[model samples]
Target: MKYNMLLIIFPLVMVGCSFSTSTESLTDEIITPDIEKIEDVGSEMITHHHMYDNMDRGNHDYVDKTLVIDPNESEIFRGDVVFFINEDGEKDLSRVVALPNETIKISNSQIFINDKKLDTFYGKAHRVGLDKDSYFKMMDKEGNDYDKEVMKKVFDYNLKEKKLAENEYYVISDDWLRGNMKVLNRETVIGKVIGYTK
Candidate 1:
């Protein structure tokens, strides 16, 4: 029993240690080619990985094709899903919500950064209309009313509008209640998603 226990715990400890020591390695003025190399970001730190079933990073069970983050890459832009360490000292991955010094607001789950409405597809300016097919496809998978449940909403609060510090970034995973968009200091960011494995 003791031996079996050691076998189970050893890998977890190794993974954790490796994650803690991992550093981002990319030169400044990086040029990302199509289909860069990637590795499994690991699943243990994720909460509700199921929410991203259709996306690449959503598959926490194994490596889904994902981009490698390069802290030295320079020019962090809106909509990049960054792999970063969180305040708790655990490694995590979330979508970049806002760049440094940008003021942002959240209304009914729609994010407005610098007074421009931002959409989930890498913080692009949201289109004027909804994509009916997108919602319907989500419904087809989860059953009736699942689409309504997936709608993003954040409670209105006095501090709804916020600006990121110079070394901070905003990231979101599924945009639900608890795991909605958040700001991660520049120190936490490892690299932007560059590409996934084939």
Candidate 2:
């Protein structure tokens, strides 16, 4: 009877020792995983990340204010933020275009800088009649009269009556690669594109 008890006790002691050794090894491997989990949780607490800390610094708040801009002007500037919607309406980006008192005009699908053609590598085809004066009366190749309905209410002041006011500039889309006929005054400009963030 004593021998049987000894046999059972011996096996139990060996099994207990084995379990302790396995537990110690598991703890050693688990410590690193636990620390990694803590680090992940800490990162999640951040509200946002600073993205512009390493970017180039420059004046990015230029605005053109020569003309009366319509809210539906397809552009908007609220405080330090500017908004521009893509033609397809799929994306909207914040940016400023012109500085105050800068004159701008688009002609022949080309943008003229200070009456001289600009060699900008950016922008799209210029739309005609964006700044046509009241004297501008013509027909398209198809003989359709120049459509002036859209600008009728937007541009209440005619060019003949009032030239670009002081401290004003015109802003247009860069998509006007060739320069759209539309002109924007610095006063009417929303803002320029500085950077983008998600």
Candidate 3:
């Protein structure tokens, strides 16, 4: 019975001893305002927000799994990670690369906003040779399984020039070569990713 009690109490005693090692040491360790910095940066984000952007050989994969999302914060901006659903009611995620009231044009394998050519690596778009312009038109209107109007809008904007509405935001990944970048509605957004776990 004594050996069993020692076995059980050993861990407890060690824990107690460590905590009471010295009042001065405990005070010294607690003096720094590390919690304040933590609070300032907001609580630790644990939600697994969406991840993407890396692509090769006509395929893509999500890059990170530890993304943190701030659902209550809805102020969207360029480069903000936005999560939403598509016309087929499929949940998806992408970054806000262009804002509303902006003109987005893709031509010559490069993206141009408001007639100013984007000079970043993200401007280079790549995708399978698909006639996305007609992909939406081919869908049935009365009994289609996709959002015809929204899909048509996105598809048309991919090949032609488009001016985003006040409630629209353009989203795309770092692999900007794809032709199906989303010009998503503001109401479709779920939240913004603020940070990621280490």
Local accuracy of candidate 1 as per-residue lDDT tens digits, 18-123: 8864243212232221234445544322222222322222223113433344555566766555666667876666666677898877654556777666534433
| CA deviation > 4 Å runs, candidate 3 | 1-46, 49-64, 126-158, 176-180
Residue pairs clashing, model 3? 125-176, 125-177, 126-177, 126-178
Per-residue lDDT tens digits of candidate 2, residues 74-160?
Answer: 333311122333345422222222334434444433444344344432221312322334223332344666445543433332222
Considering every candidate listed, which one attains the maximal TM-score? 1
Ranking of all predicted structures according to TM-score, beginning with the best and ending with the worst: 1, 3, 2
lDDT of 3: 0.56
Candidate 2 whole-model C-alpha lDDT, 0 to 1: 0.31
Please report, in order, the local distance difference test score of every candidate based on alpha carbons: 0.52, 0.31, 0.56
- lDDT agreement of model 1 with the native: 0.52
Top candidate, metric lDDT? 3
Please give the TM-score that candidate 3 achieves against the real structure: 0.52
